[model samples]
Target: MLQPRDELPSVLYSAAQVRDLDARLIAAGTAGFELMQRAAQAAWRALRRRWPQSTRVDVLAGSGNNAGDGYLLAALAQKAGWTVRVLAVGDPQRLAGDARLAFEAAQAAGVAVLPWAARTSLQGVLVDALLGTGLSGEVHSPYREAIEAINASRLPVLALDVPSGLCADSGRVLGCAVRAELTVTFIGLKLGLFSGDGPTLVGDLVFDDLRADPAILAGVPVKARRLTAAGLQALPPRQRDAHKGDFGRLLVIGGDSGTGGAALLAAQSALRCGAGLVSAATREVHVGAFLARCPELMVRGLASANQVLPLVEAADVLVVGPGLGQSAWGRSLLSVAASRSDKRQVWDADALNLLAAGVVQAPAGLVLTPHPGEAARLLGCSGAQVQADRPQAALSLAQKFAACVVLKGAGSLIATPEGELALCDHGHPAMAGAGLGDVLAGIIGALLAQGMSAQAAAHLAVWLHARAGERLGSQGRGIAASDLIAPVRELLEEHSPCLD
Candidate 1:
């Protein structure tokens, strides 16, 4: 098992795969009961650290290994002279393997084991070992009732592995889930805990490898990696003598009538993020206003795709679909942009809608940024279905479109065509406002223009954009999309600078 203080491994695994790894360890001569004991010890340590003054603990357990961990924890608390009670929701006799052994140990330790009832007064720190990663379908009757009671208690909850009723694979709530104050996860980091509803349900997250052999971890395939500042800061330094033209030009192609702000946001972000030159292709009436707002941008007024084609031909990167409508004019401009095979593309907003309509094909070396609704359109599925399994949906988008895909939502996912995945866990709810996606597209476009590979650029852009939102989110509501431009520039300088 990896140590608590060790740097987190880059690899992420699914629940089933992690279970298989546990089985492999057991088969390799380590007993399953010993692993269970280690998990209990880790949870006990985390619980005590989180709530040192609380001497009373209520352990809610089920029949699985998750329940076993709770049973062991209760026993430990009892031995320490703290009042501990074990509420078993499932028949203890039905527990198999390590779980059965844990129950026996709890009984031998003289901890009070009682049949769980909804009316049970759950006091002190509640240990939720009710469900593990093996849960699939909606949480059933008794467990749901128990979970509801636990939530109603408002006591601090310490989850054994994952919060009961949370799908460890997708982060979707199984009917309903227990909101934990702290969650001690064992073996591998489940991708679900960082995405969708996972972040909210899981409080302060803790991971313990339980001293699993390093060689064993190397054999299992990873599902995704969590984006961290250290990894994103690994961007290559710029050459001292490099000229502006070497960075690359970024052309913003959007801003239909009445939505010029979205287009301006993208152009402004690209300019702030170190694009060599920034230009906006928008409604003729908005050109003067956009130019006045940002004199550094090369604002152009175009009425047709024919007029924009020459501009598209001259640019090194294209950021399309900000405020782009599905009208004929928008379709015409998108077709022109899509026809260009040489330039790298960052497609967002209605450009994604246009692609979903079979309006154009996403060429190689392209990035697609889509929120849940847009992702649903791209996948021919409902938004609920997309959120149900965000990671899978993101990977599917990358594979089907053959482009770097950014599935934007609460826990944004960046997926590469090669099946590598990275999660951005830093954004705030204030980012739910309009034009954020457009800004993100421009940020990625700027990185690509600066010669960062599509994968690297997408990863860096997502992290920076999320961190920027987090930095600005505390400033209160109605945060304008343009507000991100300055902070994004600062972050870009901090990560990758033109002068450095």
Candidate 2:
């Protein structure tokens, strides 16, 4: 289950920004050591709550302030009469200032401080304080080995701040990061904790401001805003005298030979999400199937690019490229769709591919939904490169195309050309299926047609799609693309009811 949004701040920060926030607090008269003590206390309370019956804790310590936190936590456990040991992975002698003081306090409190070795026995619930947010380069030497050991232990682990070996800035694992089951982070929430490998490595997260002044925290710049169900901008309640034409017309353009289901899914999703009129333009062979499945959509079979011109002109919003194969038939339809600068469009799948290939240029008022591979192609980089810095990649795409870009993956990032960014971390692994992107494209299109701005539509659509998938995903895998539409519609009503 996802953590409650009320417990977390909406704003997300970079590692550097968090450090600045810490510095600001210290400058305001709160001692640095006091903040460290608060972090330890917060972590201890969370640990005890999670494992009330467990009494033993092994602290994996480094040489940084992160190690100090571990030492203080060890002291707390020792005073509580629980078996506690601090395995000093990073040489304890190198520790200085507050870290040294923390170590001395632990030793004075009768906490066992032992040098870490290859054959060190890892027992009970482990506390990972091996590395902090300052980590940049790939982890090397004993630290990597220690992180490996922690993962191998398979015991319930609690990571202080960011997980060891995980990039607090990018969420990329440096060599191998500690996979903690519970992570208690301090001060500002890091962006890496929500994107890339951060979500998978850092398990159930707990955030504490460490009692920093709210005005001080607000002064520092944030990387992005986290999109929560409660925080999303809702579509206004429909009028009692509303008619079908009250909402704008949305056209779904895609569905090549042997790939009709993709366009149908988008069209169906739009209809379910309250688009006034939804139309689908696909291959002639698939027209009958689309109409049979969803007769509400004005399904038209296209034979050439010219056939789509009229449909493109009529649509207030267009959803392009779902199962839109990289073929002549698909290319012709996308070309026509791209020509409509007046129409707000959600481009996904092969539409992104075509854009990357320079087959056509997308107009303004566009939402480009690209998975990592597609984003890589669009940016002329590898998929690994795109995943390494998802936030930057999303921003780059939005700026390059002057469009709203949804860099979809683990933590789907939504970026606007104006540099506004938002993240949706509400999806489940079970959402890994075909046609999900198509459904998302439709959802965005419907929201856009219903008078939401390009960025607002993309944000609301991504949140709704992911939340719907998360709900259905709980029933286990094998979720079809169509499975999300009803749930999305239901969730939309709950979020923005037809009647106030």
Candidate 3:
């Protein structure tokens, strides 16, 4: 059985792993049918709690364990005096094993099992039990029709375990999927529920372990860990004897020509994130505006990479890319940064492009923050391909570059060379604006300079940056990168801090 938050496991599992656990539990003495029954009861309880006044339920059933849970739930509703109808999309006779047993139980309970029609007048709460985590390909036929009907009906839906047609391994929607108002999942938390299309499809999520044995879960491996402020250990408070150089110096290298704002955003974020000192090595043309906007930042106008060597040597960490172009000047500066093995580096935007062009080698302890397109360039694949499997893509980048990789998209995945992966479930659609990645790069660089490990700083910085975007997303679109500084600062204090 799943425990409370305090007792819950830190790891999350895939759908296949959950199924394997079910098989193990059955082999270990617990009946498979009984587990299916428990799952149905959990879903039923959640449904009733969500809509206590509603006495009607329309359950769309498929031919699998997922549908078995729906049949059992319909039976429970029927027994409880609720008007329940089981719209069987797949042939109920084809149900095998525990699923067939559940179907028989529903029939014995007098639940009306009817064939679904295009005009099925579904009212009250909609229960989606069409497909489970077993889905491998796109949804087909009557099941697709049922999902469309459920979505078109404008009725509130409660998905059992996971929303039908949603790939539990990745949050990708298969052909068509049910968008439920609430999804009650079982056994262990699914990584898909927090990434890719998962957030949009699985409304308010609720997990029910279905009474699986704790020892059974120990055998399965987790794909990733969800990042939360609670998981972060507090940084030791700074002593009263701390001085200016006690923190770290961060150098921002970018701001090619017209896009000086990108470099400025990164520099500002570094300063706000607690870098002891901040400097910008940008195009000579943008120097005036850079200093005027952030006079506190040590601005240096540079025409060549040679001018940046001295600043890079003085800095504890380097944040390169941002508005950097693929021009000769940008390449020179990137080469200079790449040559220095002692300083930590954060590569974003054009810097990532340079690396992808094989213009420079990524040093160890480098953090690569690339949006979907940039990541695609690094992997030599299309952006769509990268977004399709963010976790795998991020891990591949980490392994290839031997650096911490942050693949930015709907469900941003952070992967380290050690095989550790973390997913940030926070952030909002409003963060769809430009320059946010540049800001994120600076945040990570600052954290690294402040003495945090490369991996931890990447995870912490991405989470804080995304969460800040989510906080401001409610204010509507056109969220400027500069707007995130204050909220990110507050979030940093709430998570990690060197001072009280």
Q: Of the candidates shown, which would achieve the greatest TM-score relative to the real structure?
A: 2
**Residue pairs with backbone atoms closer than 3 Å in model 2 (clashes):** none
Per-residue CA lDDT of model 1 for 1-500, tens digit only, reads: 22332266656789987998898888888899999999999999988888989999999999999999999998899999999999989889899988998999999999999999988888889999998897989999789999999999989999888999999988999899999988999999898888888999998888989999978877888889988777774446668786789779989999999989899999989988888888889989899989899999998888998999889988999999998888998999999988887899999999999999999887876899999999999999999999999999999999998899999988899998899999987888888888888889999999999888888899999988988998999887777788888888888778765454
Instruction: Write down the lDDT that model 3 would get.
Output: 0.88
Candidate ordering by lDDT (highest first): 2, 1, 3
- The segments of candidate 3 whose C-alpha lies over 4 angstroms from its true place after superposition are 1-10
Q: Output the number of the lDDT-best candidate.
A: 2
Which window of 10 residues has the lowest lDDT sum in candidate 2?
Answer: 1-10
TM-score ranking, high to low: 2, 1, 3
TM-score of each: 0.96, 0.98, 0.95
Candidate 2, residue 443: CA error in Å?
0.4
Instruction: Give the lDDT of residue 271 in candidate 1.
Output: 87
Off by over 4 Å in 2: 1-6
Candidate 1 off by > 4 Å: 1-7, 233-235, 497-500
Shift in Å, residue 428, candidate 1: 1.2
Looking at model 1, residue 484 earns an lDDT score of: 86
Error of 1 at 189 (Å): 0.2
lDDT of 3 by residue, 1-500 (tens): 22233243457778888788888888989898999999999989888878888999999999999999999999999999999999999899899999999999999999999988888799889999899888899999988888999999999999988888888888878888899988988888887777677889998877878877788878878778887777754545778898769879999999998989999999999999888899999988999998888899999989988899899989999999999899999999999999998989999999999999999988887899988899999999998888777788899999999999998877788899888898887788888888888889999988888889888888888889988998999898889888999999998887766567
